[model samples]
Target: MFDIQEIRSQFSILDREVNGKPLVYLDNAATSQKPNSVLDVCHAYYTELNANVHRGIHTLSQLATEEMELSRRKIQKFINAEHDFEVIFTKGTTEGLNLISYILTQKLQKDDEIIISYLEHHSNIVPWQLLCERTGAKLRVIPIDENGILQLDYFDQFLSEKTKVVSVNQVSNALGIVNPIEEIIAKTRKNTDAYVVIDGAQSAPHFNIDVQKMDCDFFVFSGHKMYAPMGTGILYGKREILEALPPFHGGGEMIATCSFDGTTYAGLPFKYEAGTPNVGGNIALGAAVDFMNRVGHENIQNHENALLEYAQRHLLEIEGLKVYGEKAKRTGVVSFNLEGVGISSDVGMILDKMGIAVRTGHHCTQPIMEFFNIAGTVRASFAVYNTFEEIDLLVEGVKKAQRMLS
Candidate 1:
């Protein structure tokens, strides 16, 4: 079990008072607040050892390079990848998906297919659609049940010899539906020559991730979503597949030797990282991972699940409130709409006055909104640092919004 009060003290922003009200931060899905350890590590990196890596032979460069390499190992351990060479750093989740899409399209031929799911974020869907247009391949979407879970039973119908890739989220960001990813991977691999790409942006933060157990061809996640700084992410490709795929970008750091007619690309991880990378952010990511390990990832998940359970039971008591995505054992996420409220945006404004910070909109799954027959939902996502008192305040704020909107 986690020391809940002790963990809350680690986040500096939680101490902040908003308009004489303790801030109620329920926007964990959009972005999580940084803890002090993550911040300290970033400051220490710049103040003590700030040097470009891999190209330097001096002491500062050596220190920087060592830290950079350690960061890679930290990420490898975080996802339980087989090797550090398999992990390639990127700007964020969007960049990771783009890199995979680009590399796959380069390898694919005309009339090939890539499988996607309807529950995916636009980040996962749009890149594959673009790849199809670029390579003359077709985009095949795996349908979802009315409950927003994948209709994984029908996956085989869409796959064939021409299906070269199957990219889907391990957990749906909007619906908080955790898919049976290992089963999906086994089924897809048994039937076709498709490479499995997992969008793990939501899954990485909520649960313990093990790429080896997943047996996935590719796994991608953002550091910011997992308590690291923004603009730092990773893409892990199996060694055999990564070695075979061509480089996604061309630039200074990605080349070993270049000539007028021929150029030799850099090594695996460096090959993916072009030009000046986010050294500070990457160092901070390692710190974030260290902090999470100290707190225990399993403990964090358990605490957050309890918070979600508490919120759900209390949220339903509000008149004219309908909770969406009531799947079995959800993550720390709840999407709901106030009934008889023509304008949820108006409700958010009223809640803001009371210091609640729930998100209102399509939540980046506009297609899902069309399926649910609604414009959007007000989402209140939770994090480990949140307390029962804050949840009570969240309910009070929502009830206040309901009365005002009604």
Candidate 2:
């Protein structure tokens, strides 16, 4: 049986108090709270197996290597990648997208087009902008509607022979609206031979990911957003596509054999992984995956959906409160602003005094903020452990803020 209290118990931070009140954590979209399993695994790895991976012939090194590779396999199965070699460890989603953009500089020429949507985080936008600046390529964007949903009709118009890449997020980090990635992939495949990249940083935590079913050339997500430690992430690509691209960084492990004359790169995953990796964090990521598997995605989705609906309904009932993306299908995020509240930071500060932790500002999504003709929105994003009672506190806190500020 899916027990909310049992699930909440696994996260020790949920029990803590802030400002003399219990911490009502709703800033999950920025980063999720770590469970006991994940924290324990990280601690165990450092205490028991503290050695550099893929280097020495010692037992500690061997064990460390095994644990890291085992984590890779877990991620491969998690995303349903065709091969384990396709999963490359990255610093996070930003680094993963930047890696793709940097490597594709070789393929992208002058006048070549890269397509991204307005819903993208700065990580998805700035890299492509830099790529275009370097290669003299053109950048095209798919528009969004008033409801903050992607204007799918305009996506077809952007597809053409010159289009070399179509990179988009599976879910909007700021608005929490799920994009039609499968449809986007289908359209890209039918119209052009462009490479499709799905940034799963927001979606990976809430839904089951199947790279094979999505049929995208590349997919990337941050482990920290999905209950793992910081500095751990995954970048999965088609074997053929990954093999064709050159190494992103030149360092010790990524080389086949170093020589004064010339050098050769290593195989699939190692080719991308340079220098020392976060062995403990990767192992902890595996534990995080195991934890999610134990909880089951269906239960997580159902619980979070309830939280989203209930929060939205109650938050909207407040006078002078406006919810962004209210009509769109979203995960567990609610973005809103009060009528008289000129700045989002003011509201966030007031909520902080009430022990409600919510994110404020553009959320690294300036394009989305621009579209709404506002400076920013107060975003309250949920997770598996968040409760309806906490959400009630959030609503009441916002009401208090409104009364105090407005």
Candidate 3:
């Protein structure tokens, strides 16, 4: 059985206070707090194995390289990727998406189409937009209904033989809706030869991921969002697709041979990973993955599911409060707006004063905001360490904010 208190104890920051009150951190969608195990791994890397990886003949360098590769393999197993070489180290999801967009654009031509959804974070949207801008490919969108669910009916309307790439988030960062990615991928496979990409930044932390089951051409996620150090991320590509696409960057590590006149790039994962990578972050991310394994994804899901349900029921009880994205299946995220409160920032500020940390603003998905005819929302997201007491505080905080701010 999963012990909530014991699991909470693993994270040291949860004990601290803010604003003379116990901190109720509900801003997990923005970034997660790291466990002490992950932090210790990062600290040990810097203190004990502070050496450059993959080049030096020294023992420290070799150890660093081994640890880094071990992390990659751990990620490979975590995601059920077919081969270790399929996992490429990246700065974060944004960089991974940018790399994929840049590389895929090379294979595109005029009049090609790239499809994305309205639920996408700007990181997923902008890279494809840039790709379309450069390649003369028409950018298509998969629309969403008022319930924050994807309108699959429109997918066939936008898809065609010209469709070259389809990229979407597995779970929305702002609304927390789990997209029908398997259905999307199946339909895309039936219609076109487009390469499918999944932004797993929000999904990887909440549940188990299987790249083989997803069968996506590329899958990207951020380490910081999964309780690891910042600047560590992964880009998982099918072996065939990765080998075929041109490298995203050129540097010392990604090269097999280089001359003043010409350079030949390395193969597989190294081909995409350029420059000195985030050795400590990647190693710590491995520790984070192990931590998740120890706690078990199913257990985490069960706890968070109950928490979200409890929060939603409590939030709906407050008069004039409208919770967005309730009609669809969601993760541990709830975005809402007070009836009279026009500016979400004001509510966020009041919550902060009350020691409740939540995210406010467009959350980088302005299209969704525009869909609801609102500028932004107050998002209270949950994680495994959170409890019912925190939800009570959040509710009281929201009601207080309503009376004070409104």
Quote each prediction's TM-score.
0.97, 0.99, 0.99
Q: Which 10-residue window in model 1 sums to the lowest lDDT?
A: 323-332
Please report, in order, the local distance difference test score of every candidate based on alpha carbons: 0.86, 0.94, 0.93
Residue-level lDDT of model 2, residues 1-406, one tens digit each, is 8999999999999899999899999999999999999999999999999999999999999999999999999999999999999999999999999999999999899999999999999999999999999999999999999999999888888899999999999999999998989999999999999989999999999999999999999999999998999999999999999999999999989999989999999998999999999999999999999999999989999999999999999999998999998889899799999998999999999999999999999999998899889999999999999999999999999999999998
In model 1, where do residues sit more than 4 Å from their true spots? Answer: none
How close to the true structure is residue 315 of candidate 1, measured as C-alpha lDDT?
Answer: 91
Per-residue CA lDDT of model 3 for 267-343, tens digit only, reads 88888888888999999999999999999999988998899999999999999999999889999799999999999
Q: In candidate 3, which residue ranges exceed 4 Å CA deviation?
A: none
Clash numbers, per candidate: 0, 0, 0
Q: After superposition, how far is residue 192 of candidate 3 from its true place, in Å?
A: 0.8
Instruction: Give the candidates in order of TM-score, highest first.
Output: 2, 3, 1
Candidate 3 lowest-lDDT run of ten: 267-276
Ranking by lDDT: 2, 3, 1
User: Which has the higher TM-score value, candidate number 1 or candidate number 3?
Assistant: 3
Compose the digit string of candidate 1's lDDT tens values, residues 306-348: 8888988999988778887775446878888888887668777
